[model samples]
Target chain A: MTKLTHRRLSPHILNRLIEGAPDESLALTDDHRRSLTARFRAVASNDHRRLDAWMVERAGLPYEPFRWSPASARRVVGNAALRRSLSEPTLTRGDAVALEVSDQLLRATSGYARPGSLASWLAQSSPSVVGLVSAEAANWATQLDEAAQELERPWSVAPSDAYYDVARARTTLRGRRDLIVPRGLTRVVLRVRAGAPGKSAGPGLRADLTIDALAEPTGLAASRVIGLWPEAGVVLSVDGTMEDLRAGARDLVRTAVAWQRHRLARAA
Target chain B: MTSLLDTTPVSVMDVLRGERDARPIANTTAASGLRAELEDGIFALLGPARRDAPLAIRASTLRSGTYAEDLTASLLAQVRGLLVTQALRLLSVGLEIDHAFDDALLAWRADVGSNELTRFVDQLESDERARLATDVTAHCVTLKRSLGPLSSRWLPRTSLRAYQRLAGGDVVLRDVIDLMVGTTTSDQASVALLDVTTSPLGEGAERVMRYHALVQTLRTSIVPLRTSMFSTAAGELWSANVDDELLSRAVGDVLETLRVMTVAP
Candidate 1:
């Protein structure tokens, strides 16, 4: 019995095993391949089964182990039969290629798969077993090997400038804005001086002025009807001198303002 | 005693805003009386000081028309605003403390896992684990409930305007009490040590310490004064010529008493 060379299976078959394929049909013809491609396109758009069948048929190889259903193909591709047929040199070379493809897939998908698993499966077969793998596959494998080596190099000596440029390109999409509110209450102060210094001694001598009037003048002069509350009431004692009294009134106004501001700020 | 004209008016706004420091000014009977009068005017005019105040001052006119009416309304409005603000402030404090205690209690229960003890007993045919779980769960529930009403009853019920006008406006004395009682950090070490020797009591001994801290903080914040005063009780109390310093002092005294009781060694 002729030993089936593992190299007979194409890279298209490897791609089919990794990417997955559609249902198997009995009739192995161009029309059958077309129908399978249509069915796979309905599901995933990229028909791995159609590609694999075309490669195998064009290479004029009998579909023996490769003709199984897609799920069974996944199992067989990873089996020991394929692993023994490939020489160590061929397996190692195939692994180098598979490693590149896996690395590319990972970079594209953001660390979604293990590199070792893909490399192990690809190393089980040779290019000759897979029959004339595409030039695109060979080129991708070489580029992937270079990328893997670049990644494996020491971070300290690695091309950090290139990485930084890539990172900068990613983050240049957007920025942010900030808003600030002013603090505390708005305030105004008024200083009052008695017209006649001694006239300060009498009760109800001057009427109470509204706060706004205190700030600015109005048409009507101050009214006795609006007499200050303290002026209307009788006093009990005279402990301090007139100057002291003026100073005390000033302090009280100051205290009121301070207290008002503190209260307002606390609320805010 | 002298009339308002006898005493010179100094603006309190500068002092309050920290623009000017308070001086040791003498308070003669006349000056004190004048000061009191000025305070009333200041309070009444607080609203007009706002940027969009309608009480426009005319440079030529000595009197502003409708100033008196506007001033009265403004004063009432200011008092109402103060009441509502204070009530909300107290409520917020109470809610925060209550939530903290609730969280601590939940953490304590989960840490012990007395709930799983019952399941262990059921599987083993021995009643020991079941009994322990039941006992621990009961103790935890008791401690949790001791924290008191999570929701405060002291929030203002009346309109904000009315609350400001009412004497002893919507301030709830109990809200302060709740805050003091709730925020107090119990002597955790002492409680744990005691629990080692004996089963933890429904109210751990450390609760008293927490109560003390709360009352002390509350008392320190309020200033004391000597006469009858108007204050927000729950936020609606407003009155003319009310002694605010006296009211603050009274609240302080009440908190002090509670602190003394809680801290009694």
Candidate 2:
């Protein structure tokens, strides 16, 4: 199964999360993808709905998409701004940078692409909504930038949250990776959590890495899946080995199965 | 009679940061020793840990009836606190927002989602909403003035939570700091904390602020530079610099609080 070689992540030392990451990468193989697809197809039902970690955890919840609020608005704005800051090495972190990133996002998505998304949300949002989004987003971005200070300069923000569809599996697996760093031939994937990481955080981190890998077009897998909960000043780093991939694959299959069972039971 | 504005112009940031001429020195204390004392006190109160029967004592629970047992008032307080919190998420970011009540109301409604509070608010009459609006407006005006400009350099993080388990996990002390500014990266003990309340800074305000400082100290193993409270009701600020004496007083307050609860009639 998946294992954490080093269990200790010192919160006492500031910016210890990215500074103490593992330096190993998993080589991509066609066999891995084929195995994952086969395993998913074996138990996959005709649910056809997107089965993300969130839906898998709370299958009973009938709806996932709710009306946009300050909380969700902040996430949308924060994710985009953080993505920009990480990608461009020279970009400094501040209000001016965040606002510039936000405006760039609005202009870039002015076309048919990302219509009815963050751009539209900001365009039509009231001054209060916009103001709150900007403020909250700035806080999250600043916190993340501070936490990743010691990390190497050439950091690449994951373009966007990704998803994978196994052919004939009839369901999709979604993963939202925040930042990615190149570790030689392999990569280091990171997810910045909003608050403190609790008991379920470990498994969630592995599952997220699995989903992101599955969604990635590149054949290469990450060296590790790093989880950062900045508020508590803590980091959880789990190694991405072959067993890690297998564990993530099995977890995704189990989620599909559980969702299938839950939906079927509800129908009955 | 002369108006207050004629005499002086004061901002919340000014008071919180201390005098314009003199910046308050960062104070440090033995966080481990103080935490041990608080944990030992809890152990004395509730001996022998029962893992199944763990107790969660909130900062509010330390106070008397105002924050206890009464469901309606507690629920009302929760709603009010959440609204102000949402408003701060805006104000703390340097948003030049107008109509504080309306802004916070929308924020509260949007952030709260569909819950009992949402239903309760939805069921309120026009006149009730008007009254809430008036009260919230007054509070937001004061809060907006006092919170001042947060920006990014201060590294403002809001709604930060701390959970400290004592007595072998039998007693849990939980607290949420409304806004935490400054940085812990430096060695000068440069962390400053603020607890915001929509209610007046009444008798229990200091107790709440102390509990927050205590939990933060135990959780981070770093003493805060300053711990303060601001009341939207009175537009007033109260502060206690972090030092040995303040922490010692906080530890005693917590122990006495637990004793009263353990020996309840």
Candidate 3:
């Protein structure tokens, strides 16, 4: 004759009962039965409200949501392929240049300030490629935060306790050494549906393509830049010298544009 | 069709009608039931007897009676009469001698019990019965002469010593007949009775035969059941080879699962 409440029969208790009880023993005592009836009514009411909320959200949806167009799809694909090649076990100077170009692209479109709950869900569900995507996203977000801080204080770039070592290096070994100076890296932010069709780069993709370029001791003083290209199929950071950098940048552009072409072909 | 005085004596007729002061038998129905029960018991004890033997006929005759002792005695006499009758009948049946012999034997056995006067007269003891013995011997000789041509091939083989032994009348013919019939029929019936008794253990002939056939058919059917899974393209992708042990284990698992599922709540 003990009274039972819905609160007492929590989800844990319910799960245990479902797992342990025989199929025929589903009957509940009078008080527990009454509580279940009331709980079901509350759930039904909440479901109705949730449906209405969804309808309102859909009504207020934007018409043109994407900032980046599919015009750069092929470029993104080429940059991604080059980046993969550079990160291989066997690395040459040429591979290093490609890596630098990839790194530059990765830094440029860095959007690390974004929330992580959605990405974490993707990581859990699609375990294969999530780790790399997450790393790229975090790097981009950090770069963006640093860029914002740099803009706030311009004098911070001068040789103080923070910039003195870098400055001394530049002056002491002036033209004798190929002193590599690490430039600001770009971060590319992209939103992708995991396990998408065809190439990795797609339209509606976003990422901070950071171009972290190392300054060579050449008269031109061109920084080694790498771009993070987060496209439909892959998140890539392309890096190289000025000449190689141009090639990597063009590759990213090609991937983004080809997305539309691929889409059209599929539709046809 | 002939008058009783011409065909058979007046005394024989009197004896047949029970007018000679013989005691009427008691509890004939109960006695018959007992005889049947005894026959059943005997058959339950022993197995089947050899065919065409005196033991088998004697057993059959004993099975047909109310009075056990009389039934036994009559059975022995009938068997002997059958042999004699068959020998006589064979002459006329010629080339179909075996068939004619068997038919004569059957007819003689059937009539043996009803011809009580002839049996009684044969059993009589009279030292001054020289005239009666001569008459009986004359009748026997006439019968033998009529049967001679039929038995000509085999009579030479039968010894006078065997005939004398049969006529000595010292053996309790009734007891001998009872034992022979009882042992032979009992032997035949024992096999069937044992089968019925052990039937609950599923060891009976019928059950054993059925199980044997079922096992063979099941063996054949299982091969096709396993092979059919590989006929489709999708099926080929998932094809797994099943050995006898694995198949048996799978079947056992399913049976165990069903047993658990069906347990009373």
Candidate 4:
């Protein structure tokens, strides 16, 4: 048998070699796209189901319900006002926008304690989390108020925070949908960013879109995903094709695997 | 306009609310002409820079100013929030919303990601944090005292960002307004723009205000009612009725700067 020699090139060298290559030459065929999507869907469904079963039935890992803040300090706050705008009548003034979010936040967090004393409760829950929700809420209110001046009203429906449970499992997924708008005969998931526009779909956002797509209610899946950067006044849209769904599924599986490993590692 | 630097802190709210007199922009044709001429020259100079680096004049680049400006601008947002939302507490069980700077600071920190200001705060020790908070508190107090309790009627710290394509889309002119009041109209000037700064009133102050007013005029085609400068550090306020003179001078100054920056050897 002839000995085989394999060369491992540095990533920098590999990237340099591929730099400025014709995109058409590197494009995937339709069959390749379909096959990749099918493989990803199988991994999410079949492989995920098998592993989850083993963790529960064989290893006897205790079920922990996933809990997520409806208004995390990160990206969620920017969406608060957009979500509110979709549900309420058009708000033309910043003050009105601020008032709207303040009411919604009060109602949303009413379950925690009372409306005005949320900081104390948040402090009790976690001191680091204080004022995070409020700041984001305020920023979103101001942003949407400005945006409303430019955007035409109508065409959006059923904007809300969503919670989904995996099929026959204790695991839960929480996500924010700024708006669900009809695209031709199908629906599209919309997210609005406050600052400059971004075209690249990062892994985290792709996972988020994937999870939201999978959690569609009653045979309805988002046919497209849109990200609107209002400051830059740019809209980025991606078709909800199988290829996109598979990309999302792939990210979701990677996340699930990492989460399981973290849980098991902590347990041991 | 008479100087009001007397026993009382000057009230910018009245000007923002359009209680003060405003003169129509003088020589609108001349001012507009100068602006166009200078902008074309600037784009011509910036063309080489664009070829070298396409993104040298983006929105973020437009905001690249002194560190003090960025920090003070952020701090002003918090102060504005407190003033506007003083009446209704989002999660307040009590009638009064919490006025602690510490809470507001924490919230601002949470929402802002890793930026220059955040990195600065991250490296600060407790003493440094306290010192920075104290200085911010002083500025806020002075701003509140100067502006008086802003009626929930007015919007505070309103942000404006727009891009005007110039040089046949080869060059983009980015405009940013710090805070604005009054509803803008297309046919006429209705809005009042207030430029907030941490630095004391300086030579560049009036020029900056003119630039801001000019940008708004271009954006809306209606002259801004008035342009004002509010310095939180010195507790001073200056207002000028937007006219063709200030706008023309601003255009000249911008053209000079561009000529020096890009065209000069």
- Judging by DockQ against the true structure, name the best candidate: 2
Best by TM-score: 2
Query: Which ten residues in a row are the worst by lDDT in model 2 chain A?
Result: A6-15
Looking at chain B only, the TM-scores across the models are 0.18, 0.87, 0.19, 0.70
Collision pairs in model 2: none
Predicted candidate 3, C-alpha RMSD: 49.9
- lDDT value, residue A17 of candidate 3: 22
DockQ of each: 0.00, 0.39, 0.00, 0.08
True contacts kept of each: 0.00, 0.32, 0.00, 0.09
Q: What digit string (tens of lDDT, one per residue) describes model 2 on residues B1-265?
A: 9755655466666555664344344333466688688777877777765658766677677544233352345555666677777778767766666777678767666556689987876787899878777777777777886666655666676777676666756777778888887765454556778888887877778888788878777766567778888888888888887777778988887788767666765
TM-score of chain A of 1: 0.14
Q: Once model 3 is optimally superposed onto the true structure by TM-score, how far is the C-alpha of residue B264 displaced, in angstroms? A: 58
Cα lDDT tens digits for candidate 1, A1-268? 1011111111122222212211221112334233323432333211112111112112322234332121222222222212221324345333433344444345435654354443332333232212111112332222222212222212111111010001111111010000111111211111111111122322111111111112122211111111111101111111112222223223323323343444456559
> What is the C-alpha local distance difference test score of each model?
0.23, 0.67, 0.23, 0.47
Q: Between candidates 2 and 3, name the one with more favorable DockQ.
A: 2
Of candidates 2 and 1, the better by DockQ: 2
Q: Put down candidate 2 lDDT per residue, A102-141, tens digits, no spaces.
A: 6845674666436566666666666666666666666666
Candidate 2 accuracy as TM-score: 0.84
iRMSD per prediction, in order: 39.7, 3.4, 55.4, 12.2
